[model samples]
Target: MGKATGFLEYTRINPKKRSPEERIRDWNEIRLPRDPEVVKTQGARCMNCGIPFCHSGVLLNGMASGCPLHNLIPEWNGLIYKGQWEEAYKRLTRTSPFPEFTSRVCPAPCEGACTEGHILESVTINSLEYEIIEKAFAEGWVVPRKGKATGRKIAIVGSGPAGLSAAYYLNTVGHEVTVYERSDRVGGLMMYGIPNMKLEKRIVERRFVLLKESGINFILNTEVGNDIPAQELVDQYDAVVLCAGATKARGLDVEGSQLKGVHYAVDFLGVNTKSLLDSNLQDGKFISAEGKNVIIIGGGDTGTDCVATSIRHGCKSVYQFEIMPEPPAQRIEESNPWPEWPKKLKVDYGQEEAISLSGKDPRNYLISTKKMAGNEKGEVKEVHTVEIAWVKNASGRMVPQEVPGTEKVWQADLVLLAMGFLGPEDRIADELKLDRDSRSNVKAEYEVFQTNLDKVFTAGDMRRGQSLIVWALQEGKLAAREVDKYLMGKSVIK
Candidate 1:
């Protein structure tokens, strides 16, 4: 829907970013300014395909096909092509509540599913989205719409993207909303787990300030299961939406796992980032990687962040291990297609920084740690590792099989386990007596978002396993709609 020849004429161009050396020195966002017209040129690359799979948000054949929120991709692109920044921004907010967060951290599944991405680089939809949202914010076009009173009260748990999104919509509908967070801060994982280099805390704080100004109540250090029981939440508010998150981290069962130097990635990232914010490097209160060889387990975003953080911490060296084999640089023909997520090797920002700091990539794929070696003093001294290969099982699913002679050892003074999460904590589910899905997430239907317990609901990682922030926000919005409907017997929100 952009210019007739726009997609054919212009190539994709991403916004310029500050060098890794410069960005790592401060906690600000890693981006530099981009010319608006240049962003429009990038937006113009969106081909007007009959089926825009970018908003599908579902995994087809193990790949993401579209935008989960069904964002008006082509319409916005068309507006931007015509230099309609305000219109483009308006269209964007029609679906996503926080375009700024998606612009920074989202994997850009839309670009992966773009029709043009089959042979050439996808349209710079991500950068375009970023530009539109930022412009809207800059122009003061993003003001809270205080609606006429619906006179409903809603309680939302865990102030992550999901809870925040729900509060935004519910508040817009004039439902008095109170968000409760167990942590001292509002953002659940966003405030702590994610490193500042990826998304600066100031950005989150800025939006939080807007939310507060918009009349949403934020109650920090209030745990639903502890400070206030789930039943109290049910009695105190008309409806409750659980966005408690999949916080229980997965762990390694190997020898010396409990060594003093080994720490959970969440705890490590949280403490380190908090320390950075509270006292910029002067008060070395958090865990330090300075002048030490660090070993990180797992290869997801958290692991990558640990690698990047370790580099910034002035680590002597760093290593990351993933049990699965490295993915292909391009999509697999058997499963992936032009309109589906490409299963490819992606170098995220952290990996890029790690490569720049170290001589080569810090990842050792298809490898498993057999044991953590420690001195008699009980602090981690080294780690024993083994490389492995994959073989198709009877069901044709690939499984890791270790190579007998591939065992090796690496020396490390500190160990960080970024092995991902294990769904929601047991305490919440057990206390509420809520049913769980096979994945151990709360058993709640999509859009319905209700728990097994009467008048209780769930959203975000607690309902679905650990997922993208965009997915969490969508789930939160949908869950809030369900809760609102249950409380008021029908909702304008979908």
Candidate 2:
């Protein structure tokens, strides 16, 4: 450790954020630049624990407990404490291919598992990571480093985090990688699923430019199974890596779901981002929430993003519904002890903005929508909801029991279903006849990443259901290793 007693001397400090009122006016990121000295002080708070569980990257009690990339947290923290910014950046990039994205968006499971967090506040690992990478970019330390050509060709389907990470590593190992994206832009989820207020599109664009210069090829507006035959890729490339994310949105099964003005959260967010990038949102090509009372179904990150985006669109009123009960204000020490991800209440940026604008949290817990009421014009007008109680049924399983006489109708001009994804779209699976698990995810073993089809591999949300960007990166790296080995009889990717 750089400072043995640094944990006791310093409390956790996070980066400054733009005020809710000021930031909601535009689509820029909410966080302001953090002071380098302050970040160094925060980095010093890392304790010299005998077993650094923060780097374990394990899932405990159904929640992530540490960095999925197994980042060298303590090493880089010590480097930053000693004012070695370049060394810290190097240590960061050694494991993480895209700290710029993770630093901005990842929920920081590493901090949740920090040794200091058991008794006191955890070190600001996420902010410190962002600072290190940003400094590296400013200092021109991040440049192209291409490996000698291996003369082997690989095709990566999808250009999201998983695809990009696989392309980066496989290219570095001297393989010819071509990433295919159906959209005009690269980043799938990062570009569209997430709002710009959290991760700016320009950040993704910067990485895309660097990746292109480093020798990877990007083919945009090309759908693999539809636009091009899936077998053609298998015939042309030595191996095919499918990082196409789980994008089939789960639909609300209630009545009136097909009404106009009702949409999936991804569609709503994607359209807005595409329009914004095309012309700063001047073309008005997206579903508008302006002056409309909005209802968002679901209570995860997607729902939060919908709330914030609707607010930015100048919505009249917004309401978010979560089927599950609210989490505890603090971790239940008796059940969720140290090193397990604390199941606690967290007010994300979108919730903060909603609170500022509406003078309320805008979230309704233990609520489920019954149906949507439509106006004569076929647009959504009202949402009927019911309170539910989780009670044991005859099967001895907890099931949602609707409370009698608890139905209420709320005004809703636009309803966005932010429920999670089901799995990857069936187009590719059907075209390639790839085996799928019970959950409909591509059937590929972890670490091996090989599908039943010869020379075909799958990773990320396509293999494992919808998950975090960090997990996608991990899968991509692992899959790239397997692909390299399959091509060259063995791999040295790690």
Candidate 3:
């Protein structure tokens, strides 16, 4: 709308990243700082469609269609094009509580649903967002907000994206908010589950400092259900919001899964990050992938993260296994049409680094792990796998059926299970006696976010199971709104 022919005039240019060889040597962010002029031109590429699907924030084919936070995409893009960066940052923060976190970690479903992507390439929405927030921070435009005291007290369990979001909004409305983190630091999974190369710890710490300046209280290294009883919090606070993530890592149930060298992906990532932060890996408390041929059992983001981390640790070789078939190189429009998340092959950072070193992608599609073989010391030594085909059963459900004569074995010094999570842990849920859904997640309806218990609520992964951080942020914001309405009988939070 700003340039009229901007969409036609400007081709999309992605942000630059450090080369694989250079980046693999250290634990630092992969993306280079964006050039302001390049970002402005990228912003001009937004057509500002009559119907901006980029911010629809809906679900199609069970995957997120657009920005889950419903970001004001067109408005900010227009602002950036006109050289009004401060205003663009203001428009961004109107809805998003943490653009810094999402700009780094989110898969950017918004771009997938962009109108421009339906024809030409999508506008560089993600890159524009990253620049706007970074500029805001550098210019000191970011500030804490706290409303007049409502005298209401609220407690949030877990200091992850969801919990932190709820705390931010609730504190902004002048409610006394206290966040309880079981870990030694804040930002839950963002603090440790995520590797440093993707999202630096300092970015999270920066936001934590702002939230503290806003007067929201933080209690670290203290778990609610363990250090103090759940009932005590229920009695102490006017309301309690459970943002405890779906942290029960799904186990790889197979022979020799108990081998000493086999470990959960979360444990591997978390321990490595903690050790890195505490002693720069000098403590020797973390698992080392050095001098090991690693096998990752799962082809998700977590698995990709493991591959990257392993490369950083100087792994000899690595391979990722996926039970599903490989996605097509391009979107199959007949099946995966526009507005739905496109199912296509993408060479992520991990695969890029692996390919740079080995001249081949590390992912193995349509492969399933049968079992793990261990050495005399009870340490995993090799992984047994088989290629499979998806076939319809009598129930009309697609299931993995073993292909004939496809068994294979590969040497593996370490095995990482990146199969995702099951649900929230039982400690807090059991103590609170909260009802659960069929999938073992806490029973809390979307938008409502209220549990069966009085004055108690749930949001994020605990309520919806394993999901994107964007969804968690939205859930937290909505849950905060519901809490505000319940407390004041009318709420100002939108």
Candidate 4:
């Protein structure tokens, strides 16, 4: 707990961000660092609740209610309040392997679950975590950890958060870990799927350096099911943990979906990041929105990212379409009560930049794309859409009913689909003949993490479908524990 009256005495203060106008000029991280004294005060705002639901790590109404990794938020907050920097770092690293990643990208369900947030402003737990981890690195306190050799080997597919987490723990417990990634770089989505302004590539590279120093090997530009068969990994390593994320992006089904200028949001973000890192966008390898009117389908994080990226590319104009209705500005207490992830409207960095550039938010709510039109060259030129209302069907399930008079056409030179993912790809599962769930995710139970094959384990989006990075990190940790148990009959990972 923090000071007895700290919650009453201090108010929450978040870190500042670089002005959108200034940040859009480059791909650097947008968040500015908070002063040490200010961070301490923010930490002091944590209320010493009788029951801390910030670390409950439960699912509520299909959304994460608290820290999925069960981060010791209150303890770290108290430590930071006392200026015990090293102690806070230690407490944070106890459960969180990648505080840097989560602090930057996670929606921070812990804050929504914060007891103080029910009545007052919540503690800046996410900001405090970022400060602690960065300070830990600065003080040279963070280092690679390896245990006595257990003479076992683990092959992890995908270099995403889950795979990296499992590799960190498995290597720490003296197991030889080899990670396979189809991408040229480490940190699967973190490196590519996410844009650099949100999470700088150097930050991911820093962690990758530490992981390599800790004796984990990475095979780059090699597909597990293609380059080397899925069976080959199981035959070589004592255990195999699949962390390949849910990469099979859901595609549009309407007419003109095959237009040349239409692309997946994943490819748009990934190629932009890759080209930026490779040549600072000097190469024309990425899909450009420069001087073109863009239309983005689906309004999630990916859609938001597409909007920002299009703005940065100097797109003439951009619009994002969402099939779902817009959320309330404030959480509806009747339907979404305290301690559950707030179902409210959030203006993220992308929207902020777009609003700064254009005098209005670029998102369109309750709109569905009817079809697309292309020019003679077969590139996307226009998008047809209609407004719809959510009405109950005969079966009592809500469905979209089109509003007849709301038909509209939008000028669109490039169309990006950000409708999220269906599940993991089919190559590995088909080749290995692995069982799949109803959602087409790899059939691996939580905690156990073991698939039909005894040695074949799975985690992350590949197992749970599209989810937050915090959940992936936790799954990786738990899956590592399961692999350790299988290898040595017992594990000291926890």
Candidate 5:
């Protein structure tokens, strides 16, 4: 520990955010420049807990409690506090291959499981991570580190976090790696699914450039099961790793779901980002929310992103509906003890923008959408919703039961369904004849990452269902080791 009493002497602080009023008018990131001294102070707040749970990466009550990558939190915090910026960056990259992506968008479970957070606020682990990586880039510490060629070729499908991480590790181990992306650009979710305001496209592009420089080949606008035959990849490459991600969006099964203005959140966000990148959004090739009353179904990060995106689109108003009950503002001590991931209310940036613009939080909890009403032109105009109560059914399982006489209708022209993904799109799995889990995720075990078919491996959301980027990175690293072992009968990838 840099300072034994540092935690007691310092309080946690996050980076400043751009004012909602000013930030909403543009597509730039809402975060302000971070102060180095403030980041050092934040790092000093990391208590030297003998049994630090911040890196445990365990799932408590179905939620992540710490960094999934098992980051060396205390070591980096000490390094940062001692003003060893380069050393801190080195320690950070040792576990996380892409701190830039996680720092921007990952829900920091490390902070949630911080020892100091047992009583007070947690240390700003995510912000500190961002600062460390950005400094590394600025100091030119980030450079290509290619390994000697092993005369082996590996093909990776998908260019998301998992695929990228696997390529990084495998390429560093002397194998020639090639990444295939269906989209014209790299970074599947980070480039398209996420709004530009959250993770700027240039940040993703920067990594792409560095990756190419490191001798990894990226084939854009290529789909494995479509443009390129899946069997061909299996026969050509020494090993094939699938990190295509779980992108099958859960659909709204209500009436008028097929209406013109109704769209999946992923499609809406992807289109907007693509348009923004191609022509600064002047092409009008995306679904516009301008002057329309927007209704977002779901309450997770995706729905929150939709709320924020709609606000930036100059939507007349926004309303978010969540089927679950609102969580407590503070942790319930008896159930949610210290070191567990707190199941408490969190007002994310989108809700903050909604509050700033609408004078109230736009979330309506314990409400379920009943149906959508469309106008004569086949465009959605209103959403019918009903209040719900969770009650124990005959099976003793809690189920949402609609409250009678509580149905309400709200005016809406654009409806975004962000209820999360069900599983990976079945096309790739089917084309490859790969086994699937009961939940439709690609059948592969953790750590092993081997599919039923030989020479085929799977990782990331594609295997585990929808999950965090940190988990994707972890899966990729593990899968790379398995592939390496499969290729050479042994692996040196750690």
Candidate 6:
């Protein structure tokens, strides 16, 4: 609201990205630095709508229309327009614990829900977010604050976005919180599953330092429910919060799934990220993507990551397959109104990289790999695929019916299955004898993170199945509140 005619005066501008010919040669962040004047001009595009739906952070009609974390978008945009970087960063951290991660990788539901999006391109909300936070880091305005010791001890099971957000909120409430991660570092998925090009590991480490200086404890390489039993945590702490993500990668049940050269996307990403961080490809300890023809199945973020990773590893060629039909390039049907997530075709970073490398898009929409053809030595060499079309049967449920005579075979030396996740692994649930939903996710109700057992709570993908990082953080906060309420007979966390 700093300038009434600001939105009309400035056309939408975005953060410049590294050139394709230069960026693909290495695994680094694509976003490049630009003048603060340009950022202010982009911020000037906010129309200052009366409703400010971008900050609502709720799902309407099964689609996220606003920021899931309910970010204060207008306030920060106005602050940025006024050149108040520190205040903007403070307002940003009020709701989002890790803007560096989300701003870099979030799908930007807030922008789609923006009123400006109806007429012109929406304000560059995501880039503004990234700038405000990154500037805060550069100026050293972001620092740690220790609580006044409430003498209450809490333990978080996983250190992903959910677990990290839970610890942040809980510690701010004057509780002694310690986070446990199975890996050698704090960030669970952000540390391993995500590649450095999209979200650099240094960003995670920077925040981890702040959390450590704030009196929050982090126990790395400590697996709860295995090294430290669940019962032990319950006995020691007043309440236990489980934020272990859904690590179980969904696998293809097709024939020859067991053949060599076939791998799970998460395993490939995790190992490759570690190897890249450890020695920058000097060691062959993990699965290498170098100089092989790669076929990635599934079209979500994970699949996109696979494509980018394969390309960075010097793969000869990369192909991504999606079972769903291609989305409309512009917008959803007219029936889907404003504030609903647009079901539109988006060229993510990976696809952009692939297109930059090749002359065309790498994704083959509405195609599925049916089977694998392997050589006599038991190594996968080719993949059999078929195109599909969705049609409503007599029962009215849309089903994927294959197109006859559309069967085709493609050569593939390496295949990575990036199909989403089924649910949280059942080992912890089976060990604790907790109830589960139909999807095998822990049976914990929304708004409250309580499990069937007393004083036991769940959050993040471990409870809600595979979901976005913002949702995971929100769930973690809500769950921590429920745990605090259960322990102290009152609740204050939000």
lDDT of each: 0.86, 0.93, 0.95, 0.93, 0.92, 0.87
Q: Whole-model lDDT, candidate 2? A: 0.93
Q: What digit string (tens of lDDT, one per residue) describes model 5 on residues 438-493? A: 99999989999999988999999999999999999999999999999988889888
lDDT of model 3, residue 124? 84
TM-score of each: 0.97, 0.99, 0.99, 0.99, 0.99, 0.97
Listed per model in order, the count of residue pairs whose N, CA or C atoms clash below 3 Å is 5, 0, 0, 0, 0, 0
Model 4: per-residue lDDT, tens digit, 1-494? 77889888888777899999999998889999888789988888888688999999999989999899999898999998899999999999999998999999998999999999998878888888889999999999999998888889899999999999999999999999999999999999999999998899999999999999999999999999999899999898899999999999999999999999999999999999999999999998899999999999998888888998999899999999999988999989999999998889989899999899888989999999999999999988999999999999999999999999999999999999999999999999999999999999999989999999869999999999999999999999999999999989999887
- Model 2 residue runs over 4 Å out of place are none
Q: State candidate 6's TM-score.
A: 0.97
Tens-digit lDDT string for candidate 2 (416-485)? 9999999999988898899999999999999899999999999999999989899999899989999999
What is candidate 6's lDDT per residue for 335-444, written digit by digit as tens? Answer: 57777887888888888988988889999998978999899999999999999999999999999989999999988889999998888876668878889999888888
Clashing pairs in 6: none
User: Ten consecutive residues with minimal summed lDDT in candidate 6?
Assistant: 330-339
The superposed Cα distance between candidate 6 and the true structure at residue 178, in angstroms, equals: 1.6
Query: What would the per-residue lDDT of candidate 3 be over residues 1-494, giving only the tens digit for each residue?
Result: 56778999999999999999999999999999878788878988999999999999998989999999999999999999999989999999999999999999999999999999999999888888999999999999999999999999999999999999999999999999999999999999999999999999999999999999999999999998999998899999999999999999999889999999999999999999999999999999999999999999998899999999999999999999999989999899999999899999999999999999999999999998999998899999989999999999999999999998999999999999999999999998888899999988999899999999999999999999999999999999999999999899978877
Sum up the clashes in candidate 1. 5
> How big is the RMSD of model 3?
0.7
Model 4, runs deviating above 4 Å:
none
Please state the error at residue 481 of candidate 1 in Å.
1.4
Which residue window of length 10 is worst by lDDT in model 4? 41-50
